[model samples]
Target: MQTRRTFLKTSGCLAAGALLAPNLAKAAKVKDIGIQLYTVRKEMLEDATGTLKKLAKIGYKQLESARSDKGNFYGLQPKEIKKIAGDLGMTVRSGHVHIDKDWQRSIDMAAEAGQTYLVCSSLPSEGQTVANYQRCADAFSKAAEACKKANLVFGYHNHEYEFDKVDGKVLYDILLDRTDPTLVKMEMDLGWVIVTGNDPLAYFKKYPGRFPLWHLKDMDKAKKESTEFGKGQINVKQMLQNMDKSGVKYFFVEQEEYPKTALESAKYDYDYLARLDY
Candidate 1:
């Protein structure tokens, strides 16, 4: 079973031994540098194909879309987006889906986009209470089963709300405890986890191999809000050290609030991660 990393290396691009090197000397681990396409939503909406090409040139190999609207892939048809990615030699590993009406259409759209995973980026506002969360958990269980039938992994992305206390227990913990682990994996957004006043490492230690994907963003020191990966207070290097145990297979860079241009923020994240000892 060849992994994406293996496929890229076997394309006669890099030595096999270089693929596993921790420092990633020459972006050998392309999947390691995935971009949450939501970061460039403005550019993507303007020109999906051209944006993908530019991202490929910038060294981004994998992509995670926030969501599709009306059968469109970031504003284009799923098949169109897939073809664009194929032409540019890019991969769409995962995408954001919703918990509402005709989501199956979205699933099929993702399949058309050549995506391997469909992630629920948020819970409906109605699913905000304890009972509602439990209902959402049940829905996730069913959705996960559906994803399995479609040969796609299903996951949930988190926000600060999940960390709030309900009945003296963390809502996030309840969601984790209630959801069928085999059915639903997690795409932990590191920035939101920190913002919710939780320790990212602590959750990793507790969950242990449950997080297959991560949103690697940072929080400002003064504002305590999200910033570019390097200029923020989150200790990403320390967090990344536990990837082996945390089951972090894919990590996508995300910056909801750009201090400057979003591309500049992404470049800073890329340059900083590249320089890390890993």
Candidate 2:
């Protein structure tokens, strides 16, 4: 059985080696940033394909899908979505999915759709105890194993609750400690980390290359909701600066609550990131 401590040690060495890898330098150039479709949920609900085309026209190169009323890929079949996004010169790299009885179906659909990641959008159960987190990790590891067989990566996205302490230990740490690094990866939500008064960099330093995906969001301190990128307190530039440490291969901009229309906020976020120096 692979223990968490051993997994961390092995993953740390791999992360250190990856830091000097040529690809790390290449990734620093910031090419093809993606947007999570949930940011424009209303528009997507109205017209999924058209909304995607608009995003592509706005210079988005990648997309992450969310479960919608129509289906997991917004009313379109998996292959249909892949074709549409491909036609628009954008790839559906990942999607937010539930770790439910239908998980294998989700994985199969993702594989067929050419998606590289199947991220569990939230914790499957309600408990916040360490034991509960451990159980979740075990379940995730099994799911990840199945994902590997399908040639897809399995990841978990976090919210503020994961940061709460249980017996002087962070619940998120328990999950990271319990899961196999090779089997499971993290999609760090930058806004939620700040909202919980935790630092995303600290996790990057602790887990190194384990975080390959990110929800690059900013939070309005006053409203405790996602806002346009620079309008929030998160130091977007600083987070980008530590990409090497975080080992972020791809990131998706996601905003849950916007002052303007979702499409307009999405455009604003794209422009903000495009103009960012790092």
Candidate 3:
């Protein structure tokens, strides 16, 4: 039987020794591993095609692109990026972008890229009051409607600031309570939730099935920066155990600031996740 590993070993693109010994088919291993391209943005900026090939080699089966100075796909058109990733045996499931006046264009690009979700990276307007969040919720609902027209789901990715209090209520809760769950899905960033003194498990309990996407980042407790999986304060293994409760369908590995080279950190994360059983 010429398995994928055997084929890769025979083809010379993959070294037999470098492969992770545990097969993904093993029970309890995460079925689909993904990475947010931002983790390797520098490499992409230098050589997008080369970077993607490296990621595919690293065993990232799915990707979520981050908007860069070059363009949404490091200057590659939507269809171009889609084709490139397809050839590499990976899929781009989602991306981060601002909900702005050109949002319609963003929708068009996501549709062209053959992505399932288009996430608003942050609040389009400024103001942390309840009224502001309500207004943003209204806007996001509208944005979701537009995304539906393009056959895409609309979502939001959170940072630490969303946890800040607006009056007596948590601003993030406002966004959740106000938005129509069917229209707006939240991409909870687990690391930010922990670093800011919030509990992701509680959110799962509070808003069951509201989060469909995730940025599974690990954070350093003291430095509050991203660290290699096990070295960080975050309990990556424990979080994976609760994926069902969080309603996560697609989670991407996101490391913002790492101690080693970005690609090295990414590789370490890849191995750590591959070893995880939940």
Candidate 4:
């Protein structure tokens, strides 16, 4: 999405400057930056309201929730989550859910939460074969159509396993080819893609505008665990520069293996994205 010229105004120094310095900060930024609730799972589980308020203060204005043991919305009702975030100048944008037999309830809950997208956090079926992937695709189509009727979008988030070679073919790519791009959108996890020895840019090129959501994570290349933003191997700036090709509307920063407290790591991640230009 093209950013408004006025939105480019930022504040920092010149040589090392990143703000209002249009020359330094350059064009477009991820306005309404978001975070996956899973990143702050511990804090959320402890105090959902307080934790959300803290994220809002750090300038993360959008959210993507995960299905937690405490239940969706971290023990709060769907409307309560929406109300709380809205009270803090943030929005509940998307959520990670399982598209299982209780999917209709998920759709209902997501709609009630006032979020735009309901993402299947993992594959519904349990096999890695082409037939299995195809079956998943068909199921996804049906699920997405149901979402369409409810005025919502349905998508899937990938782990490294999706890119594994099956019958000499990339299973993730096969699903992409098999599904209707309009119906079943994808939420590309950059860290997983990179860790799996795949190129996210290649996917963008092959399937332009197919991805609308992303998990913006940085992984410790050596350990394959998530770390603070700039401390990892993901070329975040490069990816941001080419975001248009990926058709990204919103991306949620996620870090599972933190160097410190989850909340502290979250704050570090928020600031990292804040200073970047692309």
Candidate 5:
């Protein structure tokens, strides 16, 4: 009883549904959103325990610790931090660490903390050349082997500099191409990608499932700095919609600049993400 026009309409509807179904499934699987503690660095330095409690109360279910003057784990030892976060119904699964000669020490500490990831926060050496980046990739592979032995995953967090072109090829691409994918997992910073005028989606497409972690910070287009979620130029909802393509297992909310107190801004970001629907 169906006419040709009706059959065509039904087929188109089914195609659209097929396209949307995967994204919806990925979004629904996302739970236990995390925050990079550096967003509240000052407060954390003064009162690590109290600040973590506040973040936990705000519904953050995971954390990524940043190095502090007090210590790598913010004055407390690795085991101590793990216990505190665990008691609060949260987990400290990753931390930003420097890739230095003492990297093995960092790895040892992270393993003791029950953390799964040790992210190199910056390039170990500074160079804007393809050769330099390739060297860095070699070093990362070595470190990643140590991490594998320690039963931890190693990753790198990129900044805008990585996007610079050398010899007409992006430096980040060189790093990606040279490094072993299993050894060097990338922790993509969404804000920096926008600030550098690069497309995160392009990277996701080029290197699908390589990014297991993300720094979900938004950039203020005018200031070119981090800002509270939903108040920036980044299309966060679009990114979340394509999370499956990025292979993101965990993401951390991080804002370096705030319109108000850090705690208040952290709460705002949490609420914004919690309310956002992909």
Candidate 6:
């Protein structure tokens, strides 16, 4: 694996100002900057080739796949998408595989995509009760063990629902406590955490290093959905400052929908990260 400095140079994304600016005095050591492909689902489904090339040009060296409308890597199949990622000098870190009958196929797809991690972004709605939560946690524990055997990391993505109290304990707490930390990691979504009335920084502090991945998104202060990075309520700089201690490895910029074009939205995010000294 290339150092982030080398990767940035090779990807041709050294910010014009960063070219002259001194090294970030207190910058956290980030391993990779990725993009959640779901942010540009429309363009991806319509023009996978062109869209991917554009993302690569924008300095996205890794991708986190979302389930397509047709399911399975925007209808191109797993191996095909992997080839595209490789050709573009990008890696597919992980993908949101729907929990379904084809779950085994999803694992195979992850291998095909050359992904080191495979995640289930959501849990089934049916099994959300206290009893179900324990069972689900156990299931995830088993899955994590299986992933370890396969030489892959398995993780769960979070939303507000996890904060709901179950038997006097927050469901998220239960899941975290019960699951084997070594086997199952977390993918923190800062925006959703904020939306649900929790503090992102608090979690980063409390769960130092438990999160290996994150969905980099910003929440609109006045709006309900996601917006551009700096224009949102989330203090991303503060979040980044804590990442090193938080053990976050890779974070993917993800804007579900934006007022402007997806590329433009992503550029704004990149610019913000680049401008910050930390």
Residues 1-278, candidate 3, lDDT per residue (tens digit)? 99998887786754543354344443387757899999999999999989999999989988999899987888889999899999999999999888887799989999999999999998988887888888998999999999999999999988889899966799999889988888889999999999999999999999999999999878887887888888888988888889889889999999988787998889999998888786
**What is candidate 4's lDDT per residue for 1-278, written digit by digit as tens?**
53565345432233346344676446765577899999999999999999999999999998999999988789999999999999999999999989887899889999999989999999999898999999999899999999988888999999989998987999998779998998899999999999999999999999998999999999988898988988989999888988889999999999998867898989999988888777
- Global CA lDDT computed for model 3: 0.89
Candidate 5 stretches greater than 4 Å from native: 1-30
lDDT of 2 by residue, 27-141 (tens): 5445789999999989988998899889999999988999878778888889999999999999999999999988989999999899999999998878989888999999899
What is the overall TM-score of model 1 with all chains considered together? Answer: 0.85
For candidate 1, the 10 contiguous residues with the lowest summed lDDT are 22-31
Error of 1 at 137 (Å): 0.5
Tell me the whole-model lDDT of each prediction, alpha carbons only: 0.79, 0.90, 0.89, 0.90, 0.90, 0.79
TM-score winner between candidates 3 and 6:
3
Looking at candidate 2, the ten consecutive residues that score lowest on lDDT are 22-31
TM-score of each: 0.85, 0.89, 0.89, 0.90, 0.90, 0.85
lDDT of 5 by residue, 137-161 (tens): 9988999999999999999999889
Candidate 5, residue 266: lDDT: 90
Residue 87 alpha-carbon offset, candidate 2, angstroms: 0.9
For candidate 1, write residues 73-107 as lDDT tens digits. 67777777777777777788899878778678878
- Taking every candidate in turn, the Cα RMSD to the unseen true structure, in Å, is 10.3, 12.3, 10.4, 8.2, 3.9, 10.0
* Least accurate 10 contiguous residues by lDDT in model 6: 23-32
Comparison by TM-score, 1 against 4, better one = 4
